[model samples]
Target: MRARPGALQVGSFRGVPIRVHVSLLVALPLLALSFGGALQQAAETADVPPGALSGHPWAWGLAVAVGLFLSVLLHEMAHTLYALRHGGEVHGITLMIVGGVSELAEVPKRPRDEAVMALVGPLTSLGLAAFLGALTWLVHGLGMFQVQFALFTLAMLNAVLGGFNLLPAFPMDGGRIVRAALTPRLGLLRATRVAAGLGRMFAVLFGVWGLVTLNPFTLVVAFFVLMGAEGESRQVRMKALLERVNVEALMTPRMVGVDLDLSMQDAHWALRHEHVSMLPVTSAGRPVGRVTWAAAQAVPEAQRGGYVVRDAMEDGVVADLREDGWAALRRMAEARVPMAAVVDEEGLLAGTLDWNDIQRGMARAEEAERQRSGPGWPRERTA
Candidate 1:
């Protein structure tokens, strides 16, 4: 599980790196304060002796906040461990302000396998709640009121976490479960559409409820769910469209290349005159990297004459001419680049591909699909 940009790597477990998102910094203290105040009130109601707990209520609240996140980590770990056991690869787990995400490198192809994988996370959380609840009984017997109270609070929170995750929300385990359940009857694409639609419906309901209750966290969660559902739906549709397409079919052939030693001023002129947004930078007649028009504009006018294409070029994705479009798109996504350089068998540049190519390909594919397939298939979104 690899963390995305803007997250801090805190530690690793069983070979999986754990990352904390920046938003957690803002959310943690607020959670601590809320939990602390609740704990104080509960303690007073229970008539616990003053000597029973020694620290400030906020200190204990902070401990509960940490414990809650740890439970979330365990919940994600359950998913990772199960996936690894069943021959699936996990990128890593990321802990964000809302909850945790277990990034599986590739989703399991089998519906049964996926359903079980999705079910295990919430099951693990519920199990944690049960174990903690039992531990609280032991603490109460030993007359450790503080320990008992903390354990009880954590148990209730774990129960809530487990229950909340069981709701059908796309890209969440519950939504995955729903998709898996429908895949046998509807096929993967249709099952994904149905599941994602249900998730969006749930998101709408949550958003309305949040507005009615004036809960900002609920509103944020609703927005997250809505975006996740829409994103998954688009990804599945794109994967279907590009699965059989190849790089050669979509790439711009006979594209021009710029020399690495070309002055930035000249490169900028070529970019404008050639009507291209980016150019492949070549070294010794071989594609090395790429420079964008934006990169050219970053250099000051006075320095453009002194700087070379090599000075502004960044790493470019290279794709094989025969590579399937889906795989090439995955590479581009991972590289965080909008375009890729395509090479033939002899390792010579054949062409270049960018978002324009993808958009055109998608349009053609959708047209072809409409002619051959039945109605109700998801339509491609405009680029």
Candidate 2:
């Protein structure tokens, strides 16, 4: 699946970009409201003097919200730093409504390393919680009731974050830990299936509980957990299927092209005759961009004859034929393009690769593996 252009890049941590999604922005106010209300009630229960706060809960709530965001960032940073120290590359950290995600370039090869990497994030949060708890005690001794309460709230929140992440659910820190533990005995793919199955079960339970309790937040979390588990399973499967494959082996070998100077009407006709949705637009028989049937049809039927294929075509991802198949697929996914224009060493148009080509390649790989290993190979099982 291609990446969408929604995340806003705030800055870089070391060399990795830090991004915030618009969903986080929407979540902030809600978080503030919830935190603020809780603080008011806690303040009352503690029998604190009215002058201690002397104001509405919004201020403290907003402060806590901001603090929570920072705490989540720190949690993700711990994961990123550990991954980096272990010779893994991080793409970036993205803060979303659910939490922060440290995008590792690839999973660690060693199970022990992966387990430790997963363990670090929750440990960091728990450590922060403990540290804040001590700081809150010191502030309380200093007679700063408001500051102490905020610190105490943050301490509790960090503690909750740590504990919640430790639950065994796929794509979560805990899920990764479980997968790592099972990897040696079950193999990576099989372990992931086991972990992912557990995650799905957890998701369904969460969803049922949310429905009974009438909690929208729990429902949202359940939905994400389910989706994340399925996504992770598919990714690991794709990786295993594409192992030892190159773009040359997976990509379509036939070079389908539409001349850059060809009219959109002609391009449409070519698309119809070739029975292909997309065709690379070539200038001097070299791919410049790609035109799709949809792009051609976007132009009015009468006006299409006046516009050239170059005018209708959009710049697309260009994959090197010699690169790894998975690498090329990643490039296409990042670009969010339907198909990629493949090129040779001399920059000559080679062929194309789309979802169909990748699916075909994976199917072939699966069949070959089945033939070698006999029926019921790579069965889903636990350690």
Candidate 3:
């Protein structure tokens, strides 16, 4: 639910990267086993020979798993493309078995826009269901019922996907719609709490149901839902506090700067000496660009002297001291910059806001909030 680490990029969609976590591979065996059984039933109905699937279940199972993940990808892209059309910036999409999440740069401030974006994924799933249903009918009509197993399974799954995602759980499209719908009446924080609360309630039911039926998959989904619900609520509360804070307060008091004419070795020394991932490039006491660890390391040691700081630096976001802390953080994340040059009223560099600064500032704020409110993790309530 929160941004996952090291999600491998599979490909790109409309210029947005589509990625999958290594954990997503966990579902393959489960779905393959499940699909293999479904394929057996379909084989019986179609009067197909047992030898068709008996030869290699591995091939069949993996094929279905990949197919299902593709469906999930398209479902998420529906959300991403819709958001883009309505002025949202898409970072990428990541597919985990729980579902696919589109990493969008902006969270829409409007309830109607949120609802529209939230509902689009399910709508897209439903569309896929209908299209697949028609295709299945045609295939079956053509007496290719054996071939319809994967198609039929996908159709059923998409139908279920559309229905399941509409359950109104936090971080899920349905829960977002609930929060958006209730924001005007109950207010943002209260609405998120209510939606997330409902999600926890659903999670409990799912967990109980899983135990009763001895279903591990249901329990896994419930675990993610519960974790995601709490995470969403916590993030919303943090952002609310972040809006009141200034970028200046969350920045390093002193940061190293590299001269534009400095060689790659000089830039590397500045980064190492300051214990920073990046160094601000300065020319005539004015900021030019920034050289990050990744860029510096890319320069061959043999030719290090030939490359100047300017050669390795890239343009980066500059944070205004007076800007909201979270807004600046968001800008930095969107740009994928390792650091931000925090500037004062006169646009002179005052300090630097890097990953470490953001982490420390947020941790301190959360600590203060916990001490003031009496530390307690939100517990799921029994309905």
Q: Pick the TM-score winner.
A: 1
Task: Mark the regions of model 2 whose C-alpha exceeds 4 Å error after superposition.
Answer: 1-6, 44-51, 85-87, 244-250, 259-277, 281-324, 343-348, 364-375, 379-383
For model 2, residues 1-383, the per-residue Cα lDDT tens digits are 33225789899888988999887898788878877777767675444555588567877788878888899999999999998887888888888887788877788888899999999999999999999988887776576887777778789879988997888878688999999998988889988988899889989998999999997767877887898889899999998777657788888875658999989999999999989998888887678888998998799999988999877888888888878778887777765677888888888888888889999888887887888888778554444
Q: Deviation in angstroms for 299 in model 3? A: 8.2
How would you encode candidate 1's per-residue C-alpha lDDT over 1-383 as one tens digit per residue? 12477788888878877888887777789778877777757665444555577888889888878888888899899999999899887767888777888877767889999999999999988998899988886676577787777778778878988888888768678888998888887877888888899889988988999999997778877887888899888887888788878989988884558888999998899889879889888776567899999999999988999999988999999988898888888778766788898888877788888889988988887888888766855543322
Where model 1 places Cα greater than 4 Å from the true spot, the runs are 1-6, 13-17, 40-54, 85-87, 261-266, 275-277, 283-285, 293-312, 378-383
**lDDT string, candidate 3, 1-383, tens digits:** 23458689989988988889877888888977866666666566545555554446666777878887888888999999998888888888999978888987767888889889999999999899999888887787565644676677678778888888888978678998998888888767778898999999999999999999998889998898999899888878767767767888799865447888999988887788877788778776566678888888898878878898887789977888889888987887777776888777766667888878877888777676677667453222221
Question: Which model scores highest in lDDT?
Answer: 2
Residue pairs with clashing backbones, model 3: none
Deviation of model 3 at 246, angstroms: 1.4
lDDT of each: 0.83, 0.83, 0.80
Taking all chains together, each candidate's TM-score versus the true structure is: 0.85, 0.81, 0.82
Prediction RMSDs, each to the true structure: 4.0, 3.9, 4.6
- Residue 188 local lDDT, model 2: 90
lDDT (C-alpha) at residue 217 in model 1: 71
Q: Look at candidate 2 and tell me the lDDT of residue 152.
A: 80
